[model samples]
Target: MKRLAAYILPVVLLACACAQQPQVSEQTTTDTSTTTPATASAAPSAYDANLAFGPDKVVELKQPESNKVIIKLMFKNGSMSDPKGKEGLTYTTAQMITESGTKDMTVSQIKDKIFPWAAGYGANVDKEVTTFTFAVHQDFLNDFYPIVRGLMLNPAFAEEDFKRVKSNQQNFVDEVIRASSDEEYSKKALEDLLFRGTNYQHMVEGKTTSVQNITLEDVKNHWRNMFTRNNLMIGIAGNYSADFLNKLKADMVQLSDAKPNIPMAGQPNKPNGVQVEIIQKDNALGSAIFTGAPMPVTRSADEFAALMVANSYLGEHRKSYGKLYDKIRTTRSMNYGDYSYIEWYDQGGSFQLPNPGVPRTANYFALWIRPVQIGEGLKQQYAELKDINVGHAHFALRLAMREVDNLIQNGMTQQDFELTRKFLRSYIKLYIQTQEKQLGFLMDSRFYGRQNYIEELDKLLANLTVQDVNNAVKKYWQTENMYITIVTDDSEAEPLKQALLNNTPSPMSYSNLVKEGLPKEVLAEDDQIANYKLNVKDVKIVDSKNTFK
Candidate 1:
């Protein structure tokens, strides 16, 4: 769970290496339609000629020279549709269909058949969509497609599979997340606080009690109700033949024709001031801090492109060139990493690119100040500093907020803006290096009512001026009102809470050898960061054992 995006450079290199490969040009359409399948009269010419759009909702990216095929079946329903008492229903139901066996095949038998083909299919359940993605060589498509068809149309839903998946999900919320990974734990806690009363409040895995309460019958009912033609969107890529595509669509029509009334998630609760939740965990090594506030704009907004430049300049995922990473990790060595996001970045610890199928209508501004040293590790590193009971948690928080405030007060310089915008224009091309990812992004574009998202964003970035970015920064970003979550050792929780409330000065601590190398100006600036004011409105301390209960 403490996984870092350490391989981002290699991923970029791989994308660059494959830049010369042939790709299908993205085509645009003027159609603005809803969930209904496109009629023959309403379909665009490019799709009509290629059979990419028709009675079935299909999004295809064809590459004639490639040897692989990628198929994705996406549904509009996800965790946001969960009922009040059964919060993990949608996610559990998705697992039941994809991870379990079909009516004709056992799980072991299906795996045995597909193992020789070097092909696999899996499911991803996010806040707004559940996508089943399949990748195989074109030679194996004839055999692999039937297995996928069975899983979608006729799942077994055996009691054993249901029990196993439910137990694992319960353990995830009850034990693994709380004990093994404070980094993810702090991030989840922050969302819980930020969207406290909304449907988005719970984790996709749901809570400990909700998962335990789910039964096999509940999964069956959910599948029958939500998996319908109205919620479906089909996407295929690679060197797939039109004949095979037609066959796939014919089989997908066997799904239930009934449409369920699923509504979009409403707005999240706004933060009154600087609200905080301090989680006390035993044997914790350091404090993991996650700060966020609700953002009014989504990708559909005109200002999003400008904010993209601002976000990249502030902190671009795992890249070390960002201002936050430069100040927190590169300069002070306070943590493993520091990053920020304007949109939801799923699994920041693992993925280098934005995972395509997890698009959301609502979003937030998040700052992830990775876990910093505390307790014995801190005392051993900086033996000279007195009154360092809670280590550098306070100082790190103040510094991060102060930098954000600086950005809000005075936007990026013209030089900084130009550099970041140019980098982003080229950097986004790396997002779709493979056929599977390309299809995923194409489907995401439909969700946001765009013809081609990456192309549109690149064009926007190309035309933007420094004033556009600064204006977006001033309009969308703020440091005054936010929700903060800190996961720290039980011994240091009370002290950290008091320091936050008292607005105490938290000076930097360093070993004698390291302090000798620092410049005079750096030490002088440290004094200012130490005393930065935080308008902390409320603070609550909760034990780890009691969380997600």
Candidate 2:
């Protein structure tokens, strides 16, 4: 009941806020002495225009919308198209196009043109696709559209601009990501561990060494080959006229129809047991832990529906009522939060909903444990515990594993299943709240070859039961064979590695003597969790500076 209330209370408030005015059945007459009554309004505009110019370009135009306009250009080729040594080439090229000068305008001149219209253009390069998004108000569409068109049609890859973008890319890998951040480091490390030998091994940003190797020739060559006419899909949603849509389509069709023969991602070999990669950093505050196994399921599969329900019960992205949240954060107060995912969920630690345009051909089930502060608080108790990340990391790992083991072993109850499904059905309504968001999701659905995911999920949840969810869990979810990546201090690597290999217990110990209101069963459960068996196949610590090199 407590868990259910945690989820339901907020939903009730949202429902009240969304209450609509009473509906009228027919037109009613009003007296002419005072005022005339207003006539009925027209039906809402169709959400999907579903117009296609050719085999290459498909457009989804939504109506009954606001003054804002969002245009997304999705190229079928992404980082996977990068040549052997040039990992970050695609992302660098995208940055150069968006941030660099155009053929007619300088970089600063391009910014000056768009800034007056309160519009901006950006690009995101994922594993399988590179999406270029253009956002502007309807009033400023004329000014913004031409600038973006210039970027797409005739980009001036100036040598000066390429040098600057490449330098920034290198700094991001060196200063911001690999050097300063544990959470960010763990994220990339997880991917590298999962797809070590494959093309999907590196982040879209590429590695530090790869960024250094990328040249002006590489960027220009990649852009010409990958960003061709046949590899594009345009998504526009706003208050645009039919004439405007036609013009945009015609302008987009001028490029040559050439598609790159990119290789699809093959399935990574399953982990033998719990493999661990400990990145040793001296100045780290807490351990950033991430673990997962590759999943064959996607939205197109029937198993995906059941997996959604089971994953929500285990850990729904930002929700507080997930089973992992209840077990780790609520019960023992281990970390800031604990969450699980059934797909390649980026920004799972902070964001409420999934971001669009990151549709993946290959997906994985992952768990993120935010930095733990155990060593900082318990240093005086244990002299060897110099790094707080190490201690908190050990406990957080055990707690996370215990919750997953229980869920996979015991499955979910009818009450648990019903509450999650009910919550999920209503929560999904919040996904496509705006015209731009709707357009983004629509493009993603088209990419996955699905018909309106939001509507389909509603129907699936309405009919799904506990048995259905558990059966999916048994088929897809697992604990024994998985990949683990943790970023922590060099001093604590051997201790942490030894702890995992030895199957040591990480029991929860209170600082104070008082044990007044705590439940004994919960405490006993933590004991078993501390000793939970992990078949750790390999464990090694590498220097932080050396990683992503």
Model 2 agreement with the true structure over 141-256: per-residue lDDT tens digits: 88778887788877889999888888778887776777655776798898888988888888788888888899998888888778865577877766677667656765665543
Please give the CA lDDT of all the candidate structures: 0.80, 0.72
> Per-residue CA lDDT of candidate 1, range 243-360, in tens?
7876776666566656777877756678888999999988898999999998998878778999999899888888899988988898888888888898878777677788788889
- RMSD (Å) of each candidate, 1 decimal: 4.7, 10.8
Top candidate by TM-score = 1
- Compute the lDDT for candidate 2: 0.72
